[model samples]
Target: MSTHALGSAKLVLAQNVVHIDPAPAVFEAMKEGWARQQSARFLRAASITPRLRLIERFGEFTGQYPWQWTPAEGEAFIAHLRGGAKPIQMSTARTYEVTIGLFIEYLMDSRYGWTEVCGERFGEGPQAVFHEGNSVLHTIEYEGDPRRRPLDYDEVQALFDAADARPAKIRGQGRKGVLAALRDAAVLKTIYAYGTRRTESSRVDLVDFRRNRKAPRFGNYGSLMVRFGKASKGAPAKRRTVLTVPEMDWVVGVLQEWLSEIRPHFAPGRHPALWVTERVGRLSPRSINEAFVNARQAAGLDEDLDLHCLRHSYITHLTEFGYPARFVQEQVGHSHASTTAIYMGVSNEYRNKLLEASMKARLGEDWE
Candidate 1:
């Protein structure tokens, strides 16, 4: 029978509804139907595969199919996840709820006719197991781990110094990874210099660097064309060009050294990538992450500090350097100024300096 024929099965509305026994073929057809509907919406296979698996796992958990699931089953599954030996985080739980909720919504859609199909076949229909009361509410702007705050100025210096010393340390040990070490240092510096995400840093092309007319002193590296900005749900990747401010002009020298002296060592023939791996291909985000991990460990910095801390440091340092909120927001490609604000972890010293400046201005006396 055609896929649509399953949904058009006859329905019984008697006081005691008789349920049709769901065959294996019938269950497989429903799964295929959901997959087809998701594919029609143009979702990537990478996104669709995990969601399909999530629904299947949920079905297994309740010992029932989608049409037989109830809100109580969902609540029990969530409780099990939270009370297990390896409890999932709130964000993770929220994502699970959202994914399952979307699947249920797709089934309940009249265009798919899964609800009618289920009613006729099993005398029931799928209900949205996740609701406002049961789901996690997104009440905070920043819900990331508290340990993942921006690095302080001293810590930033220590990290950069550690990165710079890596090649020398390798050479001293009679190792031959100096070029790779240099590449790592350059990548780490570029990440902080532009406040770029890890994927954005990995995706940089040599030609993505543009000369800024306003900052001619920076030469051809005055602005970065970020082609892989964070994308919204079901949307194309966002793009933004971050201009080189005077404070981060040190990056210009680093880029020049890498292009003219170091990157050629990798023998990157005709490749457009700014960061090339030892294999002469474009660097991956995983490699970028490893670079930061090595440097952070070498610096003896906080164990909790990760690669993203550099981006946070950039946003905080730029704010501390007296740049306007909107300028920093645009540079970091944050859709909202509030997002930029959330990334900032200004030091107590900086806060006191602002307070002192305010007091001096009001009292007409120098506070320093």
Candidate 2:
């Protein structure tokens, strides 16, 4: 008969496995190995800890985790979870179920270690166990419409003003104050002004700005070439987007006076990217989020000011100013008119006024 060891202390036979006293280091290694496997599959790092905790907690009573679970044990886990007065959300439960299923599936793949645990020990494959676990998880039900609470113009403006008013505090008398307000204001402004996706907002390069003599020079009016996005693998490359003159001028002026001044000092390698690392590298999405957090806290703004909100606000601002939906869609880099139609629904007052004007003109009131 074939024999194997589950861990340093546990010996597996065709029929039974014997356990010996195992050090915590062995379990920790197992946990790290599991984390690595999941991470390799593109699971976010933020999710790894929670999934591990769930498995550990379940293991405390069951002797083994979901990966080692049988159909009866899977059912027992469900009962244990539902026994609590406070029911967990179906979405949350589903997430855990998926994690557990993946673990079992990984073990059964034969490539991992299935040759050691097949029909001789467990009658079914890993996939069979995963299906059983999924069936139990699916019984959980949640009832509610998706919640969406979009911000109003005044609320958005308040956030902007609050960002502008943030104070800087640091140690020592001569120490430069934190430019929290300015930074926050710039972040919020850029989000709304550009209608940028979060990834795009964080990735925008300084080279996107260029001189345009044909645009209006008075007031805050200048054009900017926005790096919209990459083309498909075989598609032709697209030209950079030309933003509204007013928005471009505002962004350029602030960046030139502030970011430009500070760019050289920390940029040891003099990286050409607009958002560079202190030692000269590209600014990561994490850095952008940190800046957002600082600005939000300083301005006393609510948690609703997410990066995607800027894209919504961009569409809203354009529609409010009487720009055509098609024109707005093009500027925002959306290919669908239906996607831009959401902005049209935001202001019924504008639509009503337009309707009244059309009616009056049709009735000959303006013809005279």
In terms of lDDT, the best-performing candidate is 1
Write candidate 2's Cα lDDT for 102-162 as tens digits: 6556555554454344443345333334464245445423322223233457766776665
Question: Each candidate's root-mean-square deviation in Å?
Answer: 4.5, 8.1
Weakest 10 consecutive residues of candidate 1 by summed lDDT: 6-15
TM-scores across all candidates?
0.90, 0.56
List runs of model 2 lying over 4 Å from the truth.
Answer: 1-116, 122-124, 127-150, 167-175, 179-181, 197-199, 210-249, 259-269, 276-287, 297-300, 319-345, 350-368
**Model 2 weakest 10-residue run by lDDT:** 5-14
Question: Candidate 2: global Cα-lDDT?
Answer: 0.56
Q: Residue 190 error for model 1, in Å?
A: 0.6
Counting clashing residue pairs in each candidate, in order, gives 0, 1
TM-score, prediction 2: 0.56
Residues 132-229 of candidate 1 have per-residue lDDT tens digits of 98888998767777889999889988998999999999999998989999999999988999999999999999899999999899999989999999
Top TM-score: which candidate number?
Answer: 1
Clashing pairs in 1: none
